[model samples]
Target: MHDYTIRAFVQGNAEFVGFDKYAEVFGSTTFPTALLNTAVFTLVSILFQYAAGLALAVFFRSGFRLSGVLRAMFLVPWLLPLIVSASTWAWMLSSENGIVNSVLGAFGVPQINWLTSPDTALLSVIVANIWLGIPFNLVILYSGLQNIPGELAEAASLDGAGAWKQFWSITFPLLRPVSAITLLLGLIYTLKVVDVIWVMTTGGPGNSTTTLAIWSYREAFGTGQPDFSPAAAVGNVLILIALVFGFLHLQLQHRQEGS
Candidate 1:
């Protein structure tokens, strides 16, 4: 990673002329691609994580044999430092000597170049992120499930409501508030994620995994001449993205509260 002391003023012909780093950042080819990648990575990771977590929550709604023990075990991923998880996943997804490939080989599947290839690098990181995020979903949704009055399910059962009917008419409706909170928080957290992508791919393989967060980091820190102005511009764009999600989250929250 490149590092440089902050310069209060930019000095170059651009200063004398009419060159604008702000315009350059937006008009550049890189920004659009990074934005697109960030959106895809965040949406896909959160969607799958929520699905998997909610499933786990529902499964563990009622305490079972060793359920607490197992739930604690599930928390391992979320408890781990992002750096550790990212590094571990990097090792696991390595093309040749990776555990994932080895397991697939055992099943006679072809070895997939997970991190090295442009096509699969983003996907590999998303899968790791989903794993990292699932425990948060499970814990929050499980608490939400517990807060739900048991009588609701009892009444539904007495009314001969099937499992599906109970979930849709009862469980899912109640989960909406918690679900909204989870997704919004997930969005905020996922939007600025830089560690995993950086550690795994360094936004390489021809920039296939260069999300906005990574883009911002690279602009400020990766290049030889660290241009803080364009990097600041990119940071503002990230803030705008966050604001959009923040608005949606507030809307969801207000509607939930009003209901």
Candidate 2:
């Protein structure tokens, strides 16, 4: 086993050649593009998912009829296998036979090559990610909303505060911990997203939707020759980013608690 490990490292090092591989990656334009795409995709999807989840949570928290059933239905997307969801969306977005384009065409709107067009490819992945994540955010925020004492909102409303004011001043402040935790967790998960983008775009139509995780996979295993060192570096970078976000979340919670 030890000999095999050493042999693997030796073969991998032959290609890496010290920091040469690192320099090549940094100098490559595709590297920066992948980084930017991943950042945008993660940020936009998380923001939309969180906001939509919060709205849904608040709406369902109002105790409407079939609220429990509706909540379970919303969660169905998250519960489904991610690959299955991604493939379904991919088929739906296919320019020729996709239901999305077909419906749009029927309405006199132009059909978009969602997964094939460079401009639309990354955004398409983000849409899939948002759909996959909404349930997670909704469930977490809804539980948090349930734990918030009703008396707090009632007292705020009695003081001549309107619904919006009560929510902004009382409910939101109490949900801060829940929000912070969800945001950080979502960030971490988004950073590592691969299956949806991989199954949908394969980082193609000119490498427009390539993310770091996908890039790393391509480098280490997808290519003709395996490059483990750069893959390790990419994984390290992702871990560092996740750690920083987690630390910031904890700090935010500490400050909120102290105040």
Candidate 3:
């Protein structure tokens, strides 16, 4: 990979001479677009997963009938292997006989080409990722909710606090730690989400769904010609983003402890 990049640099086809490959990749338009797409994908997945998971956690915490069964059912997707999950989603989103299009047809809607369309391809992968993520958040948050002191809620109620008030004052506060952990872990997982996109789209439709990870993989392995330098550059960018989140989370925890 490095040898090819060096050769490319030596060929003078790329700018900056010896580091031509790096310059071309870094200076290319595709790099920025890939970064933006990935950022949006990660942000959207985390937002929806955390929100949906928190809601489910709250609902299941009430000990409603069949809550245990429901919780297990929600976790089924998470228990599946990632490749299996991606493949299943790919089948489900296929344009012709896919369940998604079938349902749309039943409702008198046009069949949508999820994987083939650049507009919806990234979103299709994001939806699959959200499915993979929500269960984890639910399990963690539900367990955290279970660990909170019942006495605190009871005390709040005794002080004439309503259910909503008690929850805001007691339940949500106690779940802060759990929420933090969930968000941090979710960010890490979403940052590295490649399989779902790979299996479903292969960064297709004019590279609309190309993420940094996918782009890096293609550069290193695609075209039967490896270029490790650009791939390494992409890897470093992803690591840097993850590291930023990790560092921020740690600082927040330390400050909370000190306070």
Best by TM-score: 1
* Total clashing pairs for each candidate: 0, 0, 0
Lowest-scoring 10 consecutive residues by lDDT in candidate 2?
A: 1-10
Clashing pairs in 3: none
**Which whole-number lDDT from 0 to 100 does residue 160 have in model 2?**
87
- Error (Å) of candidate 2 at residue 188 is 0.6
lDDT of each: 0.88, 0.86, 0.86
Residue 121 displacement (Å), model 1: 0.4
Candidates sorted by TM-score, descending order? Answer: 1, 2, 3
State the number of backbone clashes in model 3.
0
Q: lDDT tens string, model 2, 115-228? A: 999999999999999999999999999999999999988888779899888889888988988998899899989999988888899888788998888887776776677766
Tens-place lDDT digits, model 3, residues 221-241: 766767767787787778889
Give residue 178's lDDT in candidate 1 (0 to 100): 95
**If scored against the real structure, what TM-score would every candidate get?**
0.90, 0.90, 0.87
